[model samples]
Target: MRASLVPGVALLGSYPAKSLPRDLVAGLVLTALLVPQGMAYAELAGLPAITGLYTSILCLLGYAFFGPSRILVLGPDSSLGPMIAATVLPLVAADGDPRRAVALGSALALMTGAMALLAGIGKLGFIADLISKPTMIGYMNGLALTILVGQLPKLFGFSVDASGLFAELIGFAAEVAGGATVPAALAIGLGGLVVILALQRVLPKIPAVLVVVVLSIGAAAVLGLGDRGVDLVGPLPQGFPPLTIPYITLSDVPLLLAGALGITVVSLADTISTATAFAARTGQRVDGNKEMIGIGAANVAAGLFQGFPVSTSGSRTAVAEQAGARTQVTGLVGAGAISLILLLAPGLLRNLPQPTLAAVVIAASLSLADIPGTVRLYRLRRTEFSLSIAAFVGVVWLGVLPGIAVAVALSIGNVFRRAWWPYQTVLGRVPGIPGYHDVRSYPHAERLPGCPIYRFDAPVFFANARTFREQILALAESQPRPAWIIVAAEPITDVDTTAADMLRDLDLDLELNKKGVDIVFAEMKDPVRRKIDQYELTATIDPAHFYPTLDAAITAFRTTAGAEWGPAPAEEAS
Candidate 1:
């Protein structure tokens, strides 16, 4: 093994070393979790249960080799399952020709993996942050609800049409009413759900899924659920997944590209969030780009190894961490365990009941609801809450892709609205406070002596550059036409060429004919100032107008423009 690959304290640069026995114990405990979840999530993805085993094996091995997290467990996540199936089923007949569909799905995985890897190398992982928290919450909640509603038929031994969520609901209602809800299948599913939920609440450390699996399989075996008409998993393939490549045609590539990009974005978002959460728990710093690379490698391996795309399984990772897992060694062990099960107990898996798996999926989906979180967000910010609801409704009514698109567009629109109508506040000094603040916020606050300083708390890009200039002009139109306007550049971290040009033009307006107020910048960083200098803005605007600090800018304005100002006027009685 490479020295860097070794599990040691020095590998993370800082953090304590964990004992080998602890990691082994954690691996064994989490393996129990990984096996059942792998199968359940594969079912969720509309793939054969055995594919879940294959997915578990390859993704674990991949993460062990390349993932930076000491305890992250990668496998088929419930969140991505419906996405994969929805993306693939429309393009081809899922049941009629599994081979072609599988190939296309694999191709999508490979493309997504390649995209994530490229993004990581390009240091563009920050793009994941563009997926606002509200959007994610809404998306997850909608997906979970869809999965729950869609799985009801399977759980109740009925069938559902694949038209859409509404169609499925109608079909389920028509087919699964009253006595049609098979006692055996419904009982098994509901029983499993109740058991998992109960165990999760009571004995979370006991690997509830594994316990439920063993009990349900045992009950099915004893009661002979097959003879009573309950569907079974049937026999699984014994051995490791054979090496395979997805066959992609030009036409298929175009069809799958949109879905592939969606998967890539979702996968990156999920992995980064998981990595950051675990890193926080362990007091380790996560490298977002590195996390992306690891996730990409895992998906690539999954695609090549007859497996579906994978992401960091949050439940399993938490289990591993809670069980004392220390390093990637735990993942390696878990991988070996999954492979062993695939090789040895392929026949035993045949007796696994479909409803039991559905229950497991339903239970997992329940956690994704975040009702309390949604309520809190609604209380805190009505606009954000509305956006989240819009996303949820879009996902439920339209589809996942359209929902994401709407959510992103809405977020971008909100940002533009905030930038265009930038809020301006007049500064005033408070009785007990030393510095001036917004007069609107602090009624007793006093303004700075001469210059009226205003801060536009956003990057001055093309979207808002012209608006920023207009706002500055409006401020200059005040009765006395303030002698100086110091723009607090702290929040304006970036300035594009358009903005620099506008500033230069504004400086000309102030200097040439005094058509506008003189503009000065405070707390401008070197990179921004460099751009300004490169644009020859200094030719029209004085270099002395830029100050390194707000205080310095105030001092200069007091010296240069203080004589033109008068004392504060009394407020008019309301």
Candidate 2:
């Protein structure tokens, strides 16, 4: 089926009745995770904690209506939050106006959603693979480190004013040592961190944050942490979010565009990976483009309802599955549950501390660094290791955009670097083995008895086309004048126009009716054969010369050029 029609095809009816209890449990667990996670991610984005709540409620409801996954949870994510803040901060003035922030963020969400929708419709999901595993790991590790350091000040009950990540770290350190000296603040921050870390091991699902928050607010109310200069969550509106348009302008488009670009790329990658995992786990078929449309709708709706961009949350999805959620109704239930909290119990959340929220975010951010994978990369492939480190350094110093750009550049460079000098083999037979092997590695191997067979193991393009001809000619010259030559085309995927032209020229100059220097090709794929036919390379050499099987070519060579031919010289063989 075409991608545009997938949404309609993925009908939402016929859910199991057993899913009701599962949906309720999944809703409650997801709410627990979303509540603190929303607040922390909001802080990460340089937005108010209440914005997280707004984002969570709106995005969940939106996804429930449009998302394809029964259990996928969409909301503000820790990985993307810092990137959004970094993108928007440079455009806004000091202590940016809330109206301007809302407008810019909403615009970004819409832009991102539109881009994703178009891409899905076009079936361009494979574009996500352009970001290689190494580069992604490096970029994510750097992002994780940045988030951890950036949240330090908030954890210590102080704030830093620096814009760039490195400068922020320095400013935070300087302020922590000199400017801010609240013992109670330090205690709160440290206590929160310890509590969050320890509780993660024991009561993983109890929302350690809510416990720390209730205690912190209660202590502030009783022991007066507020009097000792501890930062507190100020008055938040006690009502459900009201729908409104953000103040959009022609000038704000470009700034928001950057955020949208980043968010769209990350969201597509995340959604695809998450959806595929769940589909595999549950033995269900997930339409990639369908998931894209679902997420796009959710983002569009979120922006309209004063929410930030969202992607499938891994933690919440896991909770839904564990709670036995079997249909999209679980997401609808979650949205309803969160709505009830917003309407009836908004005041119960007033006592949450910034430090506690920061701890939760820091914990999430820490998971972004795939240290084990990085170490494995270092041991396995140094080139990929270099790319990972480069991306990490670039993201840290140059910000997310420049870092992503560098990572892509590095990836392409690596491809060209390897392709320029692809793997070449000097064929020789192993002592006990019948076929020829690479002589350089296999010392005891013998060359082809008499004929020379040279294989160029990459697509013949402008970059390595000339190298292909030169290497084969040199191989022919290195050994005793060969009776015939066979160019194995198994590894050669394609030949460009330039390469084809080069082959035509080589045929005229090298073969030229010379009985002792005939050239034949075997195992060539149909596409290359078509190009060869189109270019008339097959005409001069006779139709019988192009053998589809390597054995047929070998048999013809033996009949026409005699079977007494032994392997050609090692260095000079073609």
Candidate 3:
């Protein structure tokens, strides 16, 4: 039970001796990326740069203690940064007190963490399926564009008072036209971008961001770039993050709840997806509920340490895996390294150029765009592609929080839309084939002389109940009217009350038909048959009409009608 609750204990118990060096090295390498990213994402969340470090430290430590994924690195993420800013910025006083912003941010994180924890405990991990793959692609693409546009002003060494993506883009353009951007900052930012890109192409294994950061800092310090109108991150405070509880009035909690729920959904979705992907590669399985708990713990720790929410970092996790991470010990070492930096050299990044940080963030955002995947989706499924496009537009035009709602709604709506008008077809037997296939797909196939086999691909639920009845009745009206309507019930796994009523009505309607058509269900699952009995459908329709297989139903039909039937299809015997 304890091992189930604290996965780290089990990981440590089986920790290999030879893996220690690799884990340590991976941890140190991860620190190189985490330090810069933590600060960049922190600023993106509208918090002080130092808080990013705090978030990284606590999240890494917390995840190490509770997370199930051995190599997934938890830290401040670019996607959630805008979400945090959106949720907390409005609540800050007009004067924009930094302390109040921190408190609000902490409260948001705490609330999100608590919600996620409750969801995990409730075993509601299936909720992650709310966002389909297409929706995810759209959401990430929109988020990438949003983050890119939001960072443009910083990249140009200017600030804009814009509210959203379009307004921000307009503000950025106007600033450029007005010559508000500083040349030195632009040079540094562009130089940083070029160096990172070139190194990534030439030597993909190199830590390009870290190298660029060091060079940029060195150049800024030696060339006195700060004096030439370049903005710097300034000095960060030394020592560990102070622990504090987020204080908010009851009134504030209600306002923050909506935002917290949004954050929890987005964060958990990303976490579970990343964990599942990495676990597949490593030949391991991840528990979604346990992952929720781990992520919740990380967020809770971050909130208590004057930090905002965090998520699993795919890039960081990749780096750790490549660096030979063997267990959660890698996260522990990474957290320890960051803590030591805070304790010993917190001001080391004081000369880091702000434009360069913006450049780093922009590069990270670039990774979020999935153009190739989106294009593939378009080529394969046009409707899904359109849904993806809608999700992207929703995020870009409506804002991140509202975009989440739109994306989720579109995902769920797409599911119901498919089920509501499910693909159903009449079945026929091919010349020498076994069983039955869709008549539309096998036009030359022959239909039974006085029976029509029908197949509905989805469950009979409230939404599709009427459609099921209509389609069945339409098939019954076709020429060579079926004396016995054999339903291919293999695909119909469920039958709701509404569907049961619809089925009863259909049975009564068939009974009244002058041709004397009868309905029979073939290959019906036991559970569905039991549901019919529960609905008192057995009293209305003959219980003997339920056949275990299509062949059995056909045999029974032959016996009832005293009609000679053709031999079974070749594939049936095989």
Candidate 4:
């Protein structure tokens, strides 16, 4: 049980000594990227820049101890920043107290961690699939837009006292219109963005974030930009925060819980997808439940250490892997390196320009938006495209947490819609085809006269039983109806009590009204046949009316009723 719960423990026991050097090298490479991105994502989350580093350090250490993946990197994520801010900023409100903000942020992480832990323990990792692909794409695109808009003010060298996407947009415009833009800050910000994007485009292996950050800091110190209207990160706290429980007032629990739920869904989906991608490359098996446990531990650790929630970083994981990371030891080494920085060189990033942080976040947001995926959805499926648009609108208009709720609701609604109105068709024998096929697909196919073979695609349940009964009744009342009405029962995987009862009533009604034109089931599964017996449906539907195969049903029908095959009449099209 312990091994299952903490697979990283098992990994440690089998840890090879030679792999240590590779991990050490990879860890150093990852640190160069982690430091700048962490601070940037922290700012994106509306927390101090230092908390990002705090989060980066602890989440790595925590996942190293419990994570199942050999080398998946976990840290503050750009996609999660707006969500964390949406949760924490409201409670902080007009006061904007840093301590209260940190407390709320940490507590949010705790709530998120607890929920994930419970889900992992319950083996409910399949909950991640609750959000469908199109919804996820739309939700992420909205998030990318939100992040881009939210960071614009900081990038332009000013502050916006606005909440939500539209308000922030309006505020940013007003700030720009009011001549509040600092030329030096904007220049540095735009310069950093250019350098980062160019380097990443031309030199994929180079650490663009680290490069931009180091050069920006050097420029800031040499040019005295901080003294000339530009804001600096100043200095982070001297050392790591002691472990302390995150706290918020009782009144805040409900809101925090709502946010945590959304966070948990997004985190699980992101982690699983990222893990699967990397696992495929490394030939590693991904255990979703174990992943949840690892993520839970990571969030719990961050929450206890003055940090906030986090998720897997695909870019960072790729960088680590490309740098020769062989196991979680790479994460531990990175954590240790950051710890040393906090202890010995806390002021190392003091001159890092704040605009460069915005540049980092903006770049990440660009990656999050999936225009090609959205376009593909539009080209392939209109219903799903509509769903994608709805999810996107929900996120942009209703905020991140509410947007996630909308996305989940749309996913479930889409599933129910399909089940409630499944792709039903009438089957007929084609000239050359062996088995019966959909008449809609093979028009002019010969159908047995006076006996229509209907196929209902979905499993019969209480909700769709009425539709089933009505359709069967419609088939019975059709022109020139006679003898047994054949049903292609192969697709009916399940039959509930309501459907069974309805079948019994329908069979009786056919006998009374349609003059012995009873229902004949073909290719019914054995389990469903037993269920029919269990419901005592044989008392109404003839025991002989059920057939093990469609050919058997056809043979029995021909032997009993002498029906001849002929082209479906124009009136039979319905």
Candidate 5:
């Protein structure tokens, strides 16, 4: 039996002494990346910069204890920032109190964490599968554009009163046209961007964001940019994150529930994808349910510490892995470093330009765009590419939270659409081939004289029962009408009640037809066969008609249809 619920505790007994020094150094290095990113993502989420620090500390500590992956880093993520803002923005008071905004964000984290915990406990990790890869590509692309546009005002040292992505873009354009941007802030922002981009190209292994941040701060202090009408992050409150309980009324539960569920979905999806990717590189197994538990624990901790919803950071995890992190100790050490900063150097970034932070966020958002992946999707599958584009439009036009719903709906709809009009083909024996193949792909292949094999590539469910019945009948109506029709049931992993009823009706209809055609199943799995038996379908269609394989079905058909049917095509040819 396990000694504790925390996975990290179990691993501590066997922890290698050789890895400890490397883990410590990696942790310190990771703190350099985490500080600026935490603050930037907090601002991105429409919360105070310091809360980002609080979030980062608590979430890291939480994941270090509960998370299964050794190097996985959990923190406020760029992709999830706009989503957090979208969720809590509507509930903020018209006057906008930072305290209220923080409370709302914390509440969202709590709700999101609770939902994730329930999902993990229920072993519903498959919920993450709802968002297909194409949908995710589009969603992230749209979110990137949204974050980029939203950050432009900060980078330009201006503020825009805009509600959506289009309005923000228009507002930004108008502001630029009116010369409303501060030149000093723009200079700092542009300079930071240049340094970041340059370092990324010339010295990719270095912490470019950290270097740019320190340089930008030095320049700001030396040039007294704050005195020149430039906005700064100002002094942050010192010491550790205070314990917080989100104060929300019962009336707020419904909206918060919707937002929490949306955040939960995106958070789990992001976490699982990142964990799985890094696990592949390290040759480790990822337990999705355990991941959900870890992520949920992190969120819950963040919420209790006055922070917002967060997810796995792929970039940070890579940094830790590259920095030679060997265990969750790296994350714990990183969290400790942030805690020390909060305690001892809280005001170290007081003169840091907000525009530079905006630049950091913009760079992170740009990384999330995944342009190459989208292009590859387009080249590989046009229809799926179109679906991705549609998801993008939904996010850009409908807003972030609603766009999640749209993406999920599109993914599910795509599944049903494919099933409703699933690909089906007639099978024939090609001269040089073994078993059977699609006749359409091998036009020269000959069909069995009085038997036609048809294959439907999706499960037989209510959604496609009618189509299945119609298509099979149409195949029977062909010039060389089959006396016995065999279904290639290998792909039909499931058989719902509606489909079973349809099958029964079709059997009766075929019996009444003067052509005397019979329908049989080939290569059906035992579970589906059991379902058929439960449905009492054998009363109308004989149980003996079910064959374990296509070859067995063909042999039965040959024996029944007579020698004139020709020794089973392969045997005759041999």
Candidate 6:
């Protein structure tokens, strides 16, 4: 039925010939964005601008061959720049040898690719949810601030040797105060920034970035700005690098591996989100695992050719879509165009100003921020907002790598915390409403004369076994205590060994047994009930106390304990 079992094979087999011309035109438009952005993002990552082009070319071709989504574009992205720099730059020597840096960048890309490939093969695409939306928003906000700050010195035509965000900020201020600013550099950079912002706001459909870059280059050439001390891109290296596996010191593997895992996670998240957004418009389905495999292949291709790791660029993908791209042919065409430029016209952008590249990166950084998302989180939920703020502080106060670690740890901790002390409420019959409802939501709801129905929102596990026991004990000890306590257990999807043991101990506890307050379970899942029996908790918990529904439990309690419907005592009403 199929000519090839290879990934993305069907893309070509099912290709519509009518789309060829459109793909070609879209590819040319995409190339205009890719050349400048690829170079800028590479410089942002502390690599040579030429390596960015190599990365763009190889990744585009690789994804065309392996990526699942036809319209999703892969390339060097602004958000990944600081992360790549954090991982690869420290490994470089103090002199910052460009060759060593490229080698290390390539090695990092390979490690990232291998890890992502294995993850995809293992179907671990669910790890993308490891960072909650609030935390992710905070991380991006911090990254945006970090990038914007890091590029200021380049925009002003100087360099800050200081490390850390605070140190860089201080160093930048000192440089500006010490008259280290280059007038020509500032003029071009700010002028380009203003032009880009103006055009983007006034005519969003237009390619303002391409326009500003072209005008900047023309101005530099006409005014002889390079002679006036404004730095220029000069000339890019000609042609693509030969395909060869990257190498690094054996001692560096552990560090690089750690960074690679983080990089893979972030890249996977970015890819999935971008793919989903585009697939919605194109009426396609998303496959996260396949996306991972695709990105892994792209990174491998880039690594073999002296390039760093990359991620999805939403802006560039948007450009291709607007230019009427229909399939991977657009990506192939763009790759071929870049290859031809590298071979035939490497110096076409020689007059492009360095500050203009900074402007491009800074513009990308601005787009990376999700300030409105952060504010909305704060307004909607304060607890989640705290997690967001913590993530932000982690990125700003700590470094990028550590920030990622901190955000992950916080995400996991928040999950654990909610489970350890999940929401507990008393349920009762709300007049004419439904089966049951939280009494707190309706204070006048009817309740059993001597028993209370309680609901716990999480599974019973060791982490919250003690909290569950204590809350039950408190209810049993209250004055005018009920003869029976009913647990609405539908939400308790699991009961681990420790929690089962805790339940048995509560049954045997002197306080509950002495007071003649019996505990009963209602609407528990069958699997959890089996687990309780397996743990032998039914021995002390009483097998007869289990009921199929809350209604059954109430009927049994009323029959056995002779309880009647009435409002709870004043203090326990809600």
Q: Model 3, residue 268: displacement in angstroms? A: 1.4
Preferred candidate (lDDT higher): 2 or 6: 6
lDDT against the true structure, per candidate, is: 0.78, 0.75, 0.89, 0.91, 0.90, 0.89
Query: Which 10-residue window of candidate 3 scores lowest in summed lDDT?
Result: 565-574
Alpha-carbon runs more than 4 Å astray in model 2: 1-11, 179-181, 202-211, 416-418, 431-436, 481-483, 510-518, 540-542, 563-574
By TM-score, how accurate is candidate 5?
0.96
lDDT of 4 by residue, 1-574 (tens): 5776777778888899999999999999999999999999988988988999999999998899888899999999988898899888888958788888899999998888888888888999998888999999999999999999998998999999888899999999999999999999999999999999999899989999999999999999999999889999998899889988876789999989999999999998899889999999868889898899889999999999999999999999999999999999999999999999999999999999999999999999999999999999999999999999999999999999899999999999999988888888778989887889998888778888778889999899888898888888778777677567788899999999999989988888834354667788988999988999999999988898888888998888888778889887876554
lDDT of 6 by residue, 126-207 (tens): 8777888888888888899999999999999888998889999999999999999999999999899888888878998788
**TM-score on alpha carbons, each prediction:** 0.90, 0.91, 0.96, 0.97, 0.96, 0.97
Number of the predicted model whose TM-score against the real structure is largest? 6
Best by lDDT: 4
Per-residue lDDT over 471-531 for candidate 2, one digit per residue giving the tens place of the 0 to 100 score: 7676566545665677778889988889888877777764433545667888999988888
The C-alpha stretches of model 1 lying farther than 4 A from their native spots are 1-18, 411-423, 448-450, 510-516, 547-574
Select the stronger candidate by TM-score from 3 and 6: 6
How many Å off is the CA of 21 in candidate 6? 2.1
For model 5, how does the per-residue alpha-carbon lDDT over 380-426 read when each residue is reduced to its tens digit? 99989998999999999999999999999999999889989999988
Preferred candidate (TM-score higher): 2 or 5: 5
Q: TM-score for model 1?
A: 0.90
Residue-wise lDDT of candidate 1 within 367-394, one digit each (tens)? 8888887898799998789878887897
Angstrom error of the Cα, residue 513, model 5: value is 3.0
**Model 6: per-residue Cα lDDT at residue 539:** 77
Badly placed stretches (over 4 Å) of model 6 are: 1-5, 572-574
lDDT of model 2 at position 563: 65
